[model samples]
Target: MSPQQKALLLPKKQGNFEIGSRSIPSPGAGALLVKIHSAALNPVDYKIKDLGFFVTDYPAVLGSDIAGIVEEVGEGVDNFRKGDRILAHGKFSNDFAAFQQYTLTDARFTAKASYEKIPSSESFDSAATVPLGLDTALVGLHGNHFGAGLTPPWTKSVGESKKPIVVIGGSSSVGLYAIQLARLSGFYPIITTASPSNEELVRKYGATHFFDRNLSGKEVKAAISKITDSAIGIVYDAISLPETQSVAWELLANDGTLVLTLPASVKEDEGKGRKVISTFAGPHDPQNEELCSSSWAVVEKWLSEGTIQPNKYEVLPNGLEGIIGGLERMKLGQVSGTKLVAHPQETQ
Candidate 1:
């Protein structure tokens, strides 16, 4: 029998999460067996339980941001070896997800951060925050089908554009990364909306102008005009709530694109040439595979050079068990400007 590992599981659809045990699986060809050190909590993790969306299988393990050490390298992979500190995007599949102590990672999507390029100051908790948020932001802005189809910054001779871009919910995880990517893409006067208290945090992430999230649509639009005369061609609504969607829709210029982390709530104006893209951040999807893989390839360098910064994070207590309460706080909209990380190896 394979060695069993502690995992947080949802035994059935709309079921409660509980501490459970599952056999740790081995890596297949082009994969690596990772001993997960830190797994970050995402709103989707709890939504999968309460909303019963995404997962089809019972006894599902759900988590997407993973940082850990490579335990075993499978055939045909040479970039990573045993004991390498790495971070990889996790899929919904139980064997590849982040909620378990051990999970399988596809070599193509994994970032070996211990390489000479990445600074040693990066921690497992910090690295765990990058995979999902960074991918979502990258795919939304540069993905051909899943995003606004902008030119990626990683490409050579990619010059900066002075166009203005707005990122709603700027303090949220995905919004934070969108702001930074906007800066890298050469968007001028990159503006975002968040709580006034998080103004400093969002600015640190590359937002050039910040507005209070409580502003009305007209107010936000008016405020933005005072900052930059450039039309708002792109709006990334990381929160994607109905209210934020309305604000984003109102602020967007005709023929613009509104990128969302959730389903679109605002109706597109006919003949306006506006586009709404709801980005699915999973790298395993065929449509997103190429773009995400390309972004993942440069992630280590991005982190090393400080082109991309991890979200501020708080470590959850009690190891895996603490994730339950952390999810509750997220569901209640109590967490702000920080990722919540869980130490899976500390699970009892």
Candidate 2:
């Protein structure tokens, strides 16, 4: 029998998660076998259990944000070796998922971790908060088909864009990354809305102007007009709630694209020429593979230089068992401005 590892498994479609044992998978060509240290929870994890939309197989593991140490490297992978600390965005498949002590990771989606180095600001828990949220923001802002079709900062040769961009729910995990990416893309007057308590937090992430989330659509639009005359060409609605979507639509200029992490709540009108693109992020998807690969290639440097900041995280106790309550909190809208992380190896 293969080596056994503790995993949080959803036994069936729309089923409850339970602690279970699964075989540690081996890395195939161009992959790495990772011993997961921290797995961060996202809204999609609970949504998958409730809606059963993303996974077709039963008895599945669901998590996308993974940070761990490489146990073994597969053939053709020369950059990573055994014992290297790394972080990678996981997939829906059981063997590649993050809710287990051990899983396989594609080399292309993995990045080096400085978790062990002195003076390093990153750790497994913090790095685990980055993958899914950052990828969603990247695809929403730069993906031609999945997003606004803006030029990526990594490849663009132009100077500061000086254009205005708005991020709804700026305190959200995806919202945080959207703000950072907006700054990197040279979008000035980065406007965002969040709770008063999170205004400082959002500003630290590069939101040049902040508004109260309670502001009505017209209120925000009127306030934004005073900040910049530049047309609001991109409104990344990381929240995607009906109220937030309405505000985003109000602030968007004609011909502008609204990027949403969830399905658009507002209908696009033919007469307005406005476009709404819902982002589907994950390197496993062929549509996102190329763009994700480019961003993943620079992840290590970005983390090292603090070009990208991980979200604030609270590590849940009880390892795998703690994830259940974390998901419940997320589903109940009890968790805010923070990512919940669990250490799978601590399961007992």
Candidate 3:
């Protein structure tokens, strides 16, 4: 029998999460077996339980942000070796999810920053906050089908554009990365909306202009106009609430694209060139595969060079058990401007 590992499991659709045990899976060809050190929480984890979306199997393990040490390397993979610290974007599959002490990761999505490249100040908890948020932001902005189809910054000779872009929910995980990536794309006067208290945090993530999230659509538009008169050609609504969606739509210029993290709530104007794209951040998705693979290739360099920064995070207590309460806080909208991380290896 394979060694068993602790996992946070949802036994059924819309069911409660509990500490359970599952066999640690092995690395397959082109995969790595990771001993998870930190697992970060996302709103989608609870949404999966509450709405019964995504997973079809019972007793499912759900988590997407993973940071850990490579325990074993499978055939055909040479970039990583045992004992290397790495981070990966996990999928919903049981073997690949982040809620377990050990999980399998596809080599294409795994990243390890060399000690010389990454600042010594980086931690497993910090790295765990990145994968999902960075991928979502990358795919939404550059993916031809899953995103706005903008030219990726990775390609050579791609000059920066001076166009302005707005990110609603700027303090949220995905929104924060979107703001930074927008900055990298050379979008000037990057504007975003978040709680007034998080203004400094969002700005640190590269937002050039900040507005209170409570501002009405008209108010936000007026505030943004004072900074840049450039038409807002791209709006990444990371929150994707109906209210935020409405505001994003209202602020978007004709022919602009609004990228949403949730399903579109606002109806598109017929004959208007505006496009609403609801992004699915999974790298495993065929439409997103190429774009995400390319981005993952450079994630290590981006982190090391300070071109990308991880979200601020708070570590949850009590290992796998603590994730339950963390999810509740997220559902209640109590968490702001930080990711919640769990140490699965500490599970009793």
lDDT of each: 0.92, 0.92, 0.92
Superposing every Cα of model 2 onto the true structure, what RMSD results?
1.4
Q: What would the per-residue lDDT of candidate 3 be over residues 121-140, giving only the tens digit for each residue?
A: 44788899999999999999
lDDT of 2 by residue, 1-348 (tens): 998999999999999999999899988899999999999999999999999999999899999999999999999999999998889999999999999999999999999878433233348888899999999999999997788888888997657778899999999999999999999998898999999999999999999999999999999989988889889988999999888999999999998999999898899979989999999998878888899999999999998888898999999999999999999999999988899999998999
Clashing pairs in 3: none
Cα error of candidate 1 at position 287, Å: 0.3
Q: For model 1, how does the per-residue alpha-carbon lDDT over 145-216 read when each residue is reduced to its tens digit?
A: 999999898785545577999999999999999998888888888899999999999998889899999999
TM-score of 1: 0.97
Model 2's alpha-carbon lDDT is 0.92
The residue ranges of model 2 lying beyond 4 angstroms of the native Cα positions read 115-122
